[model samples]
Every structure is written in C-alpha cells, then in structure tokens.
Target chain A: MKLGRLNHVGVATPSIADSITLYRETMGAVAIGEPFDLPAQGVKVCFVDTPNAQIELIEPLGDASPIHGFLAKNPGGGQHHLCYEVPDINEAKAWFEAKGARVLGEPRIGAHGTMIFFVHPKDMGGVLTEIMETPKDGH
Target chain B: MKLGRLNHVGVATPSIADSITLYRETMGAVAIGEPFDLPAQGVKVCFVDTPNAQIELIEPLGDASPIHGFLAKNPGGGQHHLCYEVPDINEAKAWFEAKGARVLGEPRIGAHGTMIFFVHPKDMGGVLTEIMETPKDGH
Candidate 1:
C-alpha cells in the first residue's frame, strides 16, 4: 500500500468535551473543531488540527456503540487507530488485500466526507489501520 | 508546548524482523534501517523510515523489559506511543508541568540519541506521548 501521509490519529474518549479540554487547555491546541455526531459510525467525532496532522476524538454514540467495548476495556479511552491518506482508495484496497490483509468493509463515507475503510488490526501489526482517500478540495 | 513535528510512532512488536517484513514486503515500505539494541531502554529497536515520519519497532531486550507487559496483554504487540519533535526539551517540560500534566522523568537519551521524556497518559487524552528534541541531523 502506498500510504500517502498520516492524516490523523483516532482517539476514543468517554466524553468529547473533556477530551477537547485536554487537547486545548492542557495541550494548547487552538484549532479544535466542533463535535459532530456520526450516526453511521456509532460515534461522535471531533478533529483537533495540528501543524502536521489531526487528532480525531471519538466518543461512543450510545450504549450499543462499538466504542463502548473499547471504553469498557480502557475506561479512560485510548488511541484507537492510525489513519493514513491514500491517493486512490481502490488501489490501496486491492494492494492490501493482495498482501493477505483483511479489508473490513467496502469504502464508505468517513467523518471527513471521504471514502475510507479499515484494515484489520491483526493484519496491521496489532494496530487497527484506517486508509482514507484524500479529501477533495477541502482542508 | 511547541510541538515540532511527528517524529516517529513507537510500536511494540514481538519481533522486529516480522514487523519489518510487514512494513516492507506488505506495505511497500522502503528505507528500513537495520535493527539495533537499546539496552538502556531494554528494547531492540528498528527505525522504518517513511516519507513524513518513521515507525520505531520495539521488541523486549530481556525478560525484565517494560514492553513484555504490554506484549503480554497484546500477544501480537500494538501501538505504544506517538513521538513528536520539540524545539527545546526544557521549555516543553516546563509548559507541560504548568498545564498540570505529569512529565514522566528527567530528559534522558531516547532511541534517536536525543533527550526525550514521556507525558503521562492520564493528562494526554489517554495517549502516551513522547517529546523529543529534534535530532541535530537526519536519522
């Protein structure tokens, strides 16, 4: 896979508000974005813009949300996955699949409104990996 | 604290050889550096250079290595910490302390042969962050 750039890191948190505070008041991150709900992904998301990359703060949308299990294991929440930009999603998918890695699902609209899919953790050196297509015309 | 850039992502691995295989053979990563031992840190390390940043693969050097605990929890190993370059280690330390965040210890020699310290995950949005002074020269 031709991983373009590390776009952002996914961080699972119990509360986006507290996470935002930690990133802002503590880390002095001034470019935090407004929290938004992503019902399809079963989580609320916020993008903390950094000079070189972004940090995606994820909070479980409901009790049944997939993130709930991760939060249960790590109550304080933790780093979820590392997402990298790819020039062509389909090419990356084909390459990863050919390498015997499992592509979790077909390319779907991600929080950034770009096509994205997750590669299984076991296939990605124990790190759940997200391959995202570069955002078109937007920062 | 003024974060410079994402230096490298530290990934705990059962075997750097296997991890290297994944990055090179599978992920099409080039410029993989030879593995070396960092006895002081109790880990064998390898730096896989990427276009934007590097991936540090860490394996236990001995039975008492700290990574053994993490590897035990995650048999296949997992992502450990995100390391970012800082212009001045001391200034960054003071800034983090003033923010009421815990700086692990005094600056010490890191894998890149630069002064580095870890910020407590509790204060870092549940992510163990490593702050390293920029290396004088490229790795």
Candidate 2:
C-alpha cells in the first residue's frame, strides 16, 4: 500500500479551451492533443503534459456527468481529485478496506491505461482520492 | 509560463487527524509532523510525505476560513489547488502578469522558507493556482 508519485491533477472548468490556455500559456505545459469527450464519465477532457507529469481539465457534457453537477453549482472552478500512482490496485484496496476506509468502486481501467480505485470522501475528510497503477507495457 | 511538477496537494477536511490516519496507514505516507494551527488562515493542518511531495489536509477553525466555505458548499469533497515549484517568484509573477493573468497577491512567505504567490481563480477559470520558489540557502 505504498503511494507512488502523483499521477495527475484533475481540474473542473466550464470550458476546456480556457483551461488549455491557462495551463499552456501560463504554466508552459505542452498541449498533448485536442479535447475529447468521454461519455462514460460525461466529460470532455484535454491533457497537458508537464515536464514531470500531466494535468487534466474536464468539462461536463450533460447532466449525467458528475462534473455537470459540480459546474451547475460552482460554475467556474473545482478541483476534482489527486491521483497517486500505486504499484498494485487490488492490494491497495484491500489495505484501505481493512483500515476502515470505504472503497467507492472496484478497481477499473482509467485514463493512461492505469487500474484505479477511489476512496470515499468521508474517509478522506473532504477530498476524493484515487490510487492507480500505470498500465503494464504493451497493454 | 510552464507548470512544474506538483509541489503539493491540498485537501479540505473536517479533521486532520482522521485524514492523516488514512493517508499514513493505508497509503504508506509518513506524517511530517503533528497538526499545526494556522491562525491567519483559520485552520489546522498536517502533512503527509510521499515520494515526490506532500499532501496537506486542512481543518477549518471556524466559518471564516476558505476551507470552511468550501466544506459548507460541498460537504462531500473539494481540492484546494495544485501548487507548482518555481525558481523565481518575481519573474513568475511578471511573466504571468504580462500575459493578463490576475496575480492574487504579492509574493509572501510560505511554509519552510518558501516564497509563494497565488493566481486568482477568476483569471484561471476557478482554479486558485500558485507559484512557489524555495528560498536560496542561508537567505
């Protein structure tokens, strides 16, 4: 149950374009590609590559996305979660469960081909946290 | 104008003690120190050290702190900001100001002899971003 380096930073915004400008022009992160819609998460997202890692900016496409609810209430900005790289998702989940922390979902595939799991906010005070293991080489 | 590696992740919580437990016992992070009260910020905080950086869990003393407002509005969860390490606070401020980004405050002393500045949320589309520089040794 060791936490690895940060995997990515999740940011919620009304528009991904503005986020790209801010992170790109102000922070000098390299834009990886055009924004893409993830219907499963109900978000349209773009990734920025930093010297060390990446930043993810997401906008909700419809009411079905949780991000849509976040934007509806907050409108402008929100920080989603801090994702930490883990070596083993199942082992981490088992450790959290044994320690009285509730797991929000079973380990599942996430962006960057990593296996990820979320820990409930109640257990984390008020921050949603995710643990992931980078995809093995060659899938 | 480049985002650096993440310096730290800020988590808003009701109890730093409980948050520390989960981060340490489950995630293999070591607590940096006992929770410390930030009177000016109206909160108490503790740090968990990871391989690359640290995570800060903030517990508001009352309704005056920003964390308090964040928790009131979204009791479920919230992330404060992703702080980036910079080499020169003044240069970073100047560079971003030239780009029309709103600088929240002048460089101020931060934890561990660091100089830090915040970019206003309005300028960055709701993310209260920050730039920080480690003070020169023996300065």
Candidate 3:
C-alpha cells in the first residue's frame, strides 16, 4: 500500500481554456497537453506538465457533471483531488478498506486509462484522494 | 519565469499527529518528517514525502494563524495550497505582477528555508499558489 509518485493534482475549473491560458502565460507552463472531452466522466480535461507531476485542469462537461457542485461552491475553481499511483489498484483498494478507510466505489478505468478508485474524504484527512494503478508505459 | 518543479501540496489539518498517523499507516508513507512548529508563521508543520514531491500537513499554532479561517470553513481540514519552485523568487514575483496577478506579499523565507511568496487565489485560477526560490542544494 505504499504510495508511489503523485500522478497529478486535480483542479476543477469552470473553463479549461482559461485555465490553459493561465497555466501558460502566467504560470509559465510550457508542456500543457491538448484539452479533450471525457463524456463518460462528464468533464473536459487538460494536463499541464510540471517537472515531477502534472496539474490536471478539469471542466464540467454537462449539467450532471460530478464537479458541478464543487464549482458551485467555488465558482472560480480549486484543487479538487490528489491522485497517487500504486502498483496494483485492487491491492490498494483492499489495503484502504482494511485500514477502515472508505473506498468510494469499485475501481474503474480512469482519465489516465488506468484502474483507479477514490477514497472517501472523511477518511482521508478531508482531502479527496484518488488511487491509480501505474500506467503500463510508465507515465 | 519558467516553473521549476512541483515543490509540495499544502494540506491544512487540525492535528498534525493524526495526519501523520494516517499518512504512515494508511497511506504507507515511509518518509514522514518530524512535526515542528514555525512560531513566526503561526503553524505547526510536518512533511510526508512522496517520490516526486511532498505533502505538507499544517496545523494552526494560535488564534492568529493564517489558516484558521480556512479550517473554520472546512472543519475537517482540506487542501490549502500548491507550491512550485522558481529559479528566482523576485523575478517570478515581477512576472506574475506584470501579468496582472497579485503577489500576496514580498518574498520571505519559507518553511523550506527558501524565499517564497504566494499568489492570490482569485488571480491564480482559484488555487492559492506559492512560488519559491529553488533551494541552493536543489531540494
């Protein structure tokens, strides 16, 4: 259950375009990836590369988007979650459950195309946490 | 103005001891640092090391602690800020100001013993962002 490298920091934003602009011109981020729609996940996402990790800019895709409530609470956006990689998703899930931490749901393919699951914030020091299986190609 | 590395993620917690336990037992963080008080900053701090970056757990030291308001709003505690390194703190401050983003204050020695300044959340896409001068030994 050792946490691996931090995969990314999820930031829920109202607009990915505006976020990209800020990351580029203001934050001097030079390796931002293209923004793409993830209809199944109900968000548009763009990854801004940092030296060690990434800043995931996520915008609500539809009215029923999961981040809608977060945006309503913080209209200007905010750090939504932190994703950390693990060697195996199921093992991580079981480890968390064994520790009496609530695993939000069954592991599923995540935005990074790897198995992932969310841990309940109440059980994770009030921070939304995502556990992800290391990508096969080592991203 | 290029960003150096993702230095750390700041997590505000009511108790650094409890946070450390969670990180060590549940998160399997093996490199948890000793908790220390920064009286001048009005916060108790501890660092949980990840392969790429660190998680800084902060607890208010007194009534005037800067994070008191944040903890009041989110009693369970929450992600407080994200810090990135820059080669030059002063240059970074000027760059952000020129781009119409408000630098919170003049650069001052931060927890890492490096010069750092914060950018207003409103001007930083809703995330309180800390820009730090890269440590001389390259931490």
Candidate 4:
C-alpha cells in the first residue's frame, strides 16, 4: 500500500463564489474551474488548480448535505479532508481493513468520476481522509 | 505570490511512536525519517515522506508547546496545519498582510531551519497555514 500523491485538499465553503475570490485575490491562484453540482454528494464542487495540487471548494447543496452541518459550525467554512491517489481502490481498501483501519464505505464514483472511498477519521488519526483511484486516460 | 509545492501537512500527535507505527505498518509507508527534537519549536518531529509531499508528525515536547493545547482538545491527535513553500518569505508575508490575512509573527527559523511563519486560522478559512521559505542548499 504505497501512499500515493496528493490529489486535492477538500475545503468546505459557505459559498464557492466567495471562496474563489479568496483563493484568487489572496492566494494568487488562477485557473479556477467552473462550479458544478454533485447531487449524489449533496454539494457543489469546483477545483482551483495550484502549483502542485488542487484545492476542491465544496458548498452544501441542501439541508440534508453533511457539509451543511460543517458550515453551521464554521460559517466561513474550512478544510474538510485530504485526498490521496491510489492505483487500485480495492487493494487499498483491503490493505486498510487488514491493518484494522475502518473503511467507511465500499468504492463509489467520486468527484473526478473515479473510484473512491473514505477512511473513518477515528481510525485515521483525526483527519478525515479520502482515497481516490487515479482516473484513466481519456476518461 | 506563487504558492510553491506543498511542503508538508502537520499532524499533531499525542505520541510520535504510535503515529509512526500507523503509517509504517498500516499505510505501508517505508521511508519515515528518524524522529528528532526541535527544542525551539517545543516539539518532536518526524517526516513520513510520500511520493509528492510529507506527513509531519509533531508531538509536544513540553507543556510550554502550543501543540499541548491542540492535544488537550483532541486527545487522539489530528491534522494541525497545512504548510506550503514560498519562494520569498518576505514577499509572501507582505502579500498576505495586504490581503488582510493575519500573519502570526515575524519570520522565525522553522523546524526545517528555514524562515517560516504561521497565518491565523480565522483568516485562513479555519485552517492554520504555514508559509515557509524553501531551505537553501544543504540548509
């Protein structure tokens, strides 16, 4: 289970528009992607590409969204999770389970249209972590 | 200001030894650096190098260390901060200041023996951020 390269850092936000401005004006970040809704995930997402990684800005889509609660606690929003790429999602899942780390769910399609699964925070120190399978060519 | 590559993500741990085992045995990590004391920072530090970035395990060295407070709040340890490299520390500081982001203090020698400073979490979307000047050749 070779830990892979970082795919992106998830940043929950009250409003992606306002957060985009913060990244652009304050952080000098360019190449911001258009926002798109992910109803399954119950959030709207956008990618702000940086030098070495992407900053994924996410805003709750509705009342049932998990991000809604995070936003309630932090109106301005904050870092949600760190995602690392894995070559094979199944192999990664098996490895974590064998090591007694709790895998939150079975593999599912993630934001990038790639297989992904979250590891339980309690088992992963305290930080919520996402493991994503790298997208294949021409996806 | 160009955001250089991500240097490391700081993880506050109650025990570096336990965290190291989690990474080594659970995550299949093999190249963790030896733990070292950073007396000035009041923390014991170790780097779990990954393909693209690093996981910095930081344990409070004494009660005087700020990490002790973080640990008190989160006994299980958690993500503390995200550190990014900057080409010029002074320029980055000035830019953040101009943008109304709070710079915690004057540049000081960081654990890596390079100039670094913390940005207030409130101003950084609730994530403590560290801006470090890349170390010169051979430190």
lDDT of 4 by residue, A1-139 (tens): 8878778888899889988888788777767899999888899999987667788999999778979887887787877888988889999999899988899879998899999999987888887889999888621
Error of 2 at A1 (Å): 1.2
- lDDT by candidate, in order shown: 0.87, 0.74, 0.93, 0.86
lDDT of 2 by residue, A10-127 (tens): 7888888877777777777764668888776677878776655567788887777878777776688668777788777888788889978899878877766678888886676666
Q: lDDT of candidate 1 vs native?
A: 0.87
- The DockQ-derived docking category for candidate 2 is medium
Q: Is candidate 1 or candidate 3 better by lDDT?
A: 3
Top model by TM-score, which number? Answer: 3
Candidate 3 or 2, higher TM-score: 3
DockQ category of candidate 1: medium
Tens-place lDDT per residue, model 3, A40-91, is 7789999999999999999999899999999999999999999999999988
DockQ of each: 0.61, 0.57, 0.89, 0.68
Name the docking class for model 3.
high
Question: For each predicted model, how many residue pairs clash, with residues at least 3 apart or on different chains?
Answer: 0, 5, 0, 0
Q: Give the DockQ ranking, best first.
A: 3, 4, 1, 2
Displacement of residue A46 (Cα, Å) in model 1 is 0.9
TM-score of 4: 0.94
Q: Write the per-residue lDDT of candidate 4 for residues B17-125, one digit (tens) a residue.
A: 9999988887777789999998888999999977777889999997799899988878999889888888899999999999999999799888788999999988877
Error of 3 at A125 (Å): 0.6
Which is superior by lDDT, 2 or 3? 3
